[model samples]
Target: MSKLVLSELTLSHFRSHKRATVALDGRPIAIFGPNGAGKTNLLEAVSLLSPGRGMRRAGADDLTRRPEALGWKITAILGSLHQTHELETWAEAGNPRQLRIDGKAAPQVALGRIARILWLVPSMDRLWIEGAEGRRRFLDRATLSFEPTHADAVLSYEKAMRERNRLLKDMVRDPHWYSAIEAQMAEAGATIQRNRQDTIVQLMAAQNAAPTAFPTANLTLTSPDPIPDDLQMALADNRGRDMAAGRTLIGPHRADLDAVFAEKGTLARDCSTGEQKALLISLILANGRALARDFGAPPILLLDEVAAHLDATRRAALYDEIDALGAQAFMSGTGPELFSELDDRAQYIEVTETDRESVVMQRTSL
Candidate 1:
């Protein structure tokens, strides 16, 4: 089976880099640079290859090169088999972002179908302990990787919920209006919930089958609302509370995924910081393994500052698992020492900033 590889990268008017291009070899890429050296920005550019916001979750306007001076563009050569394909993403001088594959315009969501991507950022370090929104997003990102259509269900569910909220606030008490919106919500919500359950099942199976130092987690969906097996009945039942609260409080939107360290019987949030990080790493590896087996090609992995939180042993283990899966992983760090163990097996890149301009150079061993 052929694998996906990024053969070349070019960026202009994006973040701290004014103009830069680097030819890449087919190996895990290790990028080292100081803070604010635009290390994470490179990862963010890679993330745009998939759907939704990049790693930083910045808006299209924010991504426009600072000083409001110029537009932004990112182009990359993606190789699979013996053929190469081009993907370019750009935002106008002061307009919304757009994407094109092979010079043909396409929807942003279309990217996920062509290239699945999964990532872990430094901000997600306390995901389990924080609000459910972030954890839900994390789960959805994983879900989207496995099932790109999940994006449609999420969009539909959110749209319907928004309308219902507006109706509640406006006191548009028409049962007919409620009927239509609730129907849409129920259909989309059920599908959304099912997708998440399926993704968790796949991850669980993968984790159970894989061997790694990363701690394992047991995941479950928790919500006060009973996700009805029957959509119509669910809508009718929750209508009273919905009207009173002026919000659709029961459905996929309310569901939260709970994770616990299975062996230790520890709540993910209650676990030590290191344990929590380990659990996240375990899940990410499990995700990669699952995708590799299901899709024949593992999804591209983005680990922003992944090495900073782990000890030497765990960091090495992470690399080992990634190698075994044959996935293309882009990991960022502050120096070569952080990736010393992966020296021979992975490609290396050095990032630096001088005179407020960023440059990326590929490193090779003699």
Candidate 2:
């Protein structure tokens, strides 16, 4: 299969790395360092190669190097499907982010057209135990991978909802003021709901067709209340109630993702910690497998501090699965021993902190 790889990457004034350049051959990268060594920062940089606010949901100014706060830039040699392109993204202090593809200025959504990125962060480990908001975001990311246009739908839905909420907060009683906004929300909400549902179906099929050490999860889309079949009318009907509550109540924004461990027939939230983590890994790997078949190549995976949670056997299984996929996964841990399972199948990077600044360098040997 063809591959999507970042053959080369450069970062300047980005979070912990003041300046660093890494050359690669598209192998999975094993990054090891002490806590706060800026290891996750490296993955966050890679996450920005796609659209969105990176993995941390940090703002542009938040990504700038401190003391200087002189904005940051990332440039990459991206290999997508059968084409190669120069992808660049950056932000100046006090300004929004910008992007360029192959030396031509482009919108952030343009990056989504050519690149597919999937990630698993430590913060996401508690996904099943946490509130529905986090699960929605996780499902949306998976959905976005399958359908890049998912981002536009999410943005449109959110923008329209904000306006509707504003009218509700002001106790607007006129239907004329809300008709247009509700129409936009209903249209975009339908797209969001459809894309998420389709993604869940794809993920379930991906899990069933594959044999892996990780546990499979039966995924479903849910909400606080029944999602209305006629959303526009529902919005109009709920306006009085929403006005009393001072917010838009029932819509895609209130949706949730529910999962069950197929083997044990137990809810994910009630499973043991290890089982929960394994289920997450299962879903992520399933997403990767599905994308490999659907998108022509596996996506670049950012796994932040993933080794810390798995046993030696499970760690080896994870590595083997990633290697078989031919995916360039960027995984991190607190020490090189955590990555012994990867051996020569992966490259190595070591990060350190000096004078409160992160220092990154490629290592020839672990």
Candidate 3:
């Protein structure tokens, strides 16, 4: 099978790194650094190689290095299925970011076709207990990994919903404006729902087929009320109530993802903190395995501070699974000992901040 790897990466004026570059082999990468040394910043840069606002969802303005605040750029040579593409994503003075593939300007969504990326960050440890928005985003990211076009569907649905909400806020009762916007919302919303459902099925199948230490999670795509079979009709019917509420009430935007520990039958939110993390890891691995089966390669995974949460046994198991799957998983921690088990199996990079500038040094071994 072909492998997906970032053979080379360069960062300039991005976050804490003024200028840094790293060469990679087709193996998982273990990055260790001190607090505030900009380790997660590196992962965030890699996350941008895909789509969306990256792992932090921060605007371009927030990504630029301070003092200089001169904008930032990330360039990479992406290897996928025996093919190579030059990818560049950047922003100028906090403007919206742009993408270039092989020297040609392209929309952000275009990167989705060639680069499949998924991530688990420190903040996501609270995902199960947080509001539905976070869970929905997690599901959508998985869906996007499976179907790149899912980005387009989400964008369409959100755009239409935004317009509809405006009309609601303005108390515009004209049926003409409502008909077109609602129709667009219904079309895109339906696509969004279908993609999410399909991804859940794929994840479930992958979880059942794999034999791993991580616990399995039973997932369901749900909403407060039954989604109308004909979304257009639902929108038309909800118009009165929506205007009163000043928002679009019923659509894919309001959807939620519910998960339970398959073995324990306890809601993920109610699971022990460690159990919750395990469930998330299980789902992420399952998502990767499923993609590898369907796409000839697994998506690049960004796991920030993941090692800190796992016990020695589970940490060793996690490394074994990552190696077995042959995924280019990028992990970060505060010290090399956190990734001791992965010593020779993964590449090591040490990051340090000196004089307020971050430096990335590739080490051959611990």
In order of appearance, the predictions have TM-scores of 0.96, 0.98, 0.98
Looking at candidate 3, the ten consecutive residues that score lowest on lDDT are 107-116
For residue 291, give model 2's deviation from the true position in Å.
0.5
Window of ten residues with lowest summed lDDT in model 1:
60-69
- Tens digits of per-residue lDDT for model 1 on 56-99? 88887787667755889999998754457799999887688999
- TM-score, candidate number 2: 0.98
Judge candidate 1 at residue 19 and give its lDDT. Answer: 86
Q: Write the per-residue lDDT of candidate 2 for residues 130-188, one digit (tens) a residue.
A: 99999999999999899988999999999999998899898889999999999999999
| Local accuracy of candidate 3 as per-residue lDDT tens digits, 260-322 | 998989999999999999999999999999999988888899999998669989999999999
TM-score, candidate 3, is 0.98
- Between prediction 1 and prediction 2, the one with superior TM-score is 2
Candidate topping lDDT: 3
Which of 1 and 2 is the better model by lDDT?
A: 2
RMSD of 2: 1.0
